[model samples]
Target: MKNSKRWGRRVLSALAAAAVLAAVPVGAAGNGKSKGKPPASSHRYIEVQLLGINDFHGQLNVTRKVGGREVGRADYLAAYLKQREAENKNTLLVHAGDAVGASPPVSALLQDEPTIEVLNKLGFDVGTLGNHEFDEGVAEMLRLIHGGYHPATGDFAGADFPYVSANVVDAQTGKPILPPYVIKRVNGMPIGLIGVTLTETPTIVTPSGVAGVKFIDEATAINKAVRELKKKGVQTIVVLAHNPGVSNPDGTNASGEIVDIAKNVDDEVDVIFAGHNHAYLNAVVDGKLLVQSYSYGTAFSDVDLKIDPRTKDVVAKKAEIVTTYHDGITPDPEIRALVEKYEAKVAPLVNQVVGTAAETITDEQNESGESALGNLIADAQRAAMKTDFAFMNPGGIRADIEQGEVTWGELYNVQPFNNQLVKMTLTGAQIRQLLNQQWQPTQTRMLQISGLRYTWSASRPVGEKVIDIQLPDGTPLKPDAEYTVTVNSFLADGGDGFTVLTHGTNREVGPVDLDALVTYIRQLSQPFSAQIEGRITKLQ
Candidate 1:
């Protein structure tokens, strides 16, 4: 009897799903319409605009000079978006992902609450999840979406918009952490939106940030969600993925992993919005539109989709990459006020003098492969942990400590993730293996180091790159010798494609990396300054 009941339920479900699919035209641009001519006035088309941004990273008060124009700050973005949307009545403002994470002192210090409030006021309809969304862990991410107080940082109102991720799921329950998709009605047309993040999210972020959640393949997740949305009579689909883009100038023929995913996804998906590489791209792939504005609130992607009223399917689409310049654009008073509230709150902690820099430490690395800032950080880590040696990832150092007094906020911006120092033991050979790992997967940045020096031939074959290794005193490195190595928690967890670090044993974790820098800087007898010392020599 139970078996019979289950079978009956399946049959009923199939019938209902079929009815839903029949109600909506769920295929190509003109799915249910004749291809002969334009529809009549009664079946007129409505142009719906999609205003998208990605990797905002909570730059409420930061600015970047792009193309010789100073731009950015959440206020400028709000003002420009408001002006643009004013011209188009039917518009939806959305973010691809990383709206907040690895932010500056102004936003990061407040746990990004102010950014959320500003986004809410900005009228963000919906957004996706980037790997950074998981930086503070899933619980914090959930808190950011729903109204609640942080366990450590008091209560506050939360986001007005929902953050969806079709790919992020619970391992045990096999259920998504958030809603897989959201349907928004624009100009009387229901647009289905599915959100996805890079499947490699775990590899990039701190391991604890995404525990118990599984990030699945982007294309598979999108195809599945597209099918479900189609069955619900929602045909116009867009995917917000937190993946890097293979950029091409203008909106024609840009190719990358996103393009590959677009090609594999079902035809029902009309657009792809992406983040993670902080790039500006305008491309059409798989007969669909894909875009990503550069990060830090400096740019936005404006896409227009013409929907046929008769079929509710997207018939024509065009996209442009818009740079957000502060010139001539007045800051939205509400957003500026919102940013100032947080800015005022963080002043005391951020404005404290940390240390001094006699020489300007730039992020630009020398030919031998070391940046002054990177060397200083690596030195600080080694000093703080009392390790035999320490190495820093090139990506971790976000800003340069100028030749002046480095404030606490400046130090925070340099190592904003608040990662702790991890000391572990590795065989000399394993250390070499770690060096070789840098060249893998196409990113060949040598780590910023302290207490050791090595030369690797870039022209040499992959595995045998590191030619000579020695300590600072000229003692030769022995493959059989075990040595104490220090790295940040991100590296110890094998982040940034350095899986070899996971093998290290006898782990001893210490203070946060930024804190280590703070203490190390204060202890410097002179203003803390470092120069690239040819620690990592790459063959020309």
Candidate 2:
């Protein structure tokens, strides 16, 4: 019953043609509502299906298309999970992180109430927190953690599951913001779940959103959690880490921060369910299964684990990633209804045509961290404030700008966060320092730039990276000359490990980033097309 690779999802005994394949006897309990322990057998191996979703980002609608087929709709996702569960006796559903934040208006405007409500209905047991989870700040996250109706999105009973984060520390109390870990009983086996996020969280997230919080090392946090869980007599452990590795489509060799963290974590940890970078991968690192599903509700990871009852340990494991296609699967009626109800509330605003795109500008980054969408966003920020130049973090661009009519939904997907533009002044030397600040030991902060041009050598050390700097008008930058600049408040406050941006003087604030994009699109008399235009040249 184990599906070995990251692909290979075929229902073994799917009776219904419309139902997603599951030849294996469908479990009545994958939603964490049914008892999955084997019948009193002393030496039986209990088969369990662990369904994982990561980086959902509140995609309730069926908007993203693959080969002209609608995939990743909330209803379709629900239907797939339901059908898959019917085949396995024991099952558990969990999310890695980023369930909300940078989401569409249908979910974001309601303050992500709809997102939380739908997840509750799906019956998740536990989930971790990603950087986006703190977009609205700790107070709003608390509102999501404990059940109650939110003022903006109205009624939401809150999540049925606990949000765990062992690494996120509260600055005031110097303790983990949420529960470090949670233990769930699947059948009779005590399954311990440890959650953690990248310690670089502060650099990527808005400083204000995470004002009083600090993130600790992922490996250290998980090891400590493992020691605590072992003391509770739990033998089976799963690490739901919000930090992810670079996407390797083949599921072969891959390396990133998560890879390093995985190599260093205690061997007591079993599978690592990762997120935050929206990568789809499944590979064994240090003999531990590491898996991730592509983001935006477009895909999910289906992992099957066999636990030995006598030894109380995982004996066998199989993992595969499944795309949530719409045609062959039946969309859950209840979830579809829920989506319609929430979407109706924001229809007027979300349906509006904000702009048009003659080409598809995606958020995917290059080796040097350049993206066409990032460049477009930077251009808009500079245009909005009429500054000498502007910058955008690569992580800020969420989705691609598809061809044809650009609706508010598409723009919202791109700039989901309501970050305001901050205009300021900095000298040429300070700007060079900003460029040099891009290279961290574990990260490269390639700020998408506009109204200026620069070249960098990867072979060069951190402080000596930037060379041949010039303004957009082809004027060479003078070391002592100061120029007006515009950036998001996040970067202005030294977000994303770039401190040079914070040194700028004459700070000024502008409209929200989304608003600027909407206004920029409306003003365009023709379809807008984005290009790299040699704005950034990286020499490896």
Candidate 3:
């Protein structure tokens, strides 16, 4: 095994620099030209292109629609990356995280090894973790990155590239779990890449996923890494952060956690690639360029930097968010074959027809914060657990059930976390408090419900938003009355900030959530459907 300390010790060999020019998308900031004025004729700058993508989520065989154009799929993403790499040999391919976990069947079924293999084939230089990377726990994550044995897929070669995360550390040791940063040389100048994931990881991931690790402040970890990199004479620094942020289509009005991180980090940090929210962001704050591509391989961030070779610092930087539209380029045949191989391997189980939807049941929430898909899944869990009510976090419902036959593969995509069902007891008042938590200061997460209804007031205070709660039979929920409640393992453990769930008693673990959903669909009459039944009401 390679020495863990040596992970970031090697300095990459130098590469020749070249000019990069690409057309900018509409509503973005960069003009497809280098940003700064030309350097003195005697001072030639080293141009390095950083190609980055975030929140991939292992959509190996999935295609998504962006602005009416069919995009995504691993092969197409590979083609786009390869084309961009050819434009500048000094380019470094990097990802901000969520490369795996919550993945579709093609990759998830094989334990996400295919995603790692694809990254290896594409030659990813450096990467960082997103919350989803901890979905199955640290051991599984390391197995996917550094290679190890898995019962389902046998031995694996793991990731070819190094993964750096300064913030995630050992719970007992209080030391970084991986190299905090990696250094690469371009034109004989050292460039540092530091990594950090959101500190809210513990709350978002299942307990076991982060069993022995603790996440610290993103900026603190970053600034400390910066000091270390500076001591080593590295001036040009980039951060690969699995944090959230968003910006207007024109790259204006940027705000999110990453924006706050950018403002606080050392000014020597030249660029940050953000992720987790899976949104488009291309803006400059605190003189540092920050960018994020919309997730699922549909887009990528192309950041160009002009590094002053003598001073070893980035003097000029600009970025453009590029959509992977399938209008012109052909998908890479080799990657397509790789995807097909995995697909065929899992076909027998995933391709089985589970049920049919009479019409599209989407996770799109209405003004009342209710969705048909969420209702369907919540009803399934409630029914499976024989509970009085069930609540599903909106984020857990990943995709829509379109009009037509629904396959196990499609269902797997909907709830990929494999969280088991938890049946517990909660008082009616406790349920009300749970509903109120949907409107927290940091986030507004509406919980999808089954077998009950509630009205919440927007004008009311955060903890008092829920005005009333009642059973489906029109019986008002009694504050002192106890009732059974059902939620997936994630929520029962207080994931997504639903801390009220943790107070529940008499918890009984049930089948995997996907199994409950599958059984519910199977036992239903053909062409069965679910809809918003006024389960949630919003008052202005």
| Per-candidate TM-score against the hidden true structure | 0.90, 0.87, 0.93
Give the Cα-based TM-score of candidate 2 against the true structure. 0.87
Better of 1 and 3 by TM-score: 3
Candidate 3 residue pairs that clash:
27-250
lDDT tens string, model 3, 1-540?
A: 000000000010000000011233322221222223324555588888899999888999998765445768899888878877776778999999989888899999899999999999999999999888887889989999899999998999999999999999999999999999999987788999999999878877778889999999999999999999999999999999998887765567889999999999999999999988777678888888888877888777888888888798988888877766666777889899999999999999999999998889888788999989999999999999999999998888777788899999999988887888999999988998898888877778888999898888888887998998888888899999999999988899888788999999999999999999999999999897888878999887
lDDT of 2 by residue, 189-228 (tens): 8898888976766766666678888888889999988999
Ranking the candidates on TM-score from highest down gives 3, 1, 2
**Segments in model 3 whose C-alpha atoms lie over 4 Å from true places:** 1-43
Error of 3 at 79 (Å): 0.6
Better of 2 and 3 by TM-score: 3
Q: List the residue pairs that clash in candidate 1.
A: none
Per-residue error for 25 in candidate 3, Å, reads 5.2
Give the Å shift of residue 498 in candidate 2.
1.6
* Model 1 C-alpha lDDT per residue in residues 460-535, reported as the tens digit of each score: 8888888999999898889999999999988898887788899999999999999999999999977778887788
Which candidate comes out best when scored by lDDT?
3
Pitting candidate 1 against candidate 2, the one with the higher TM-score is 1
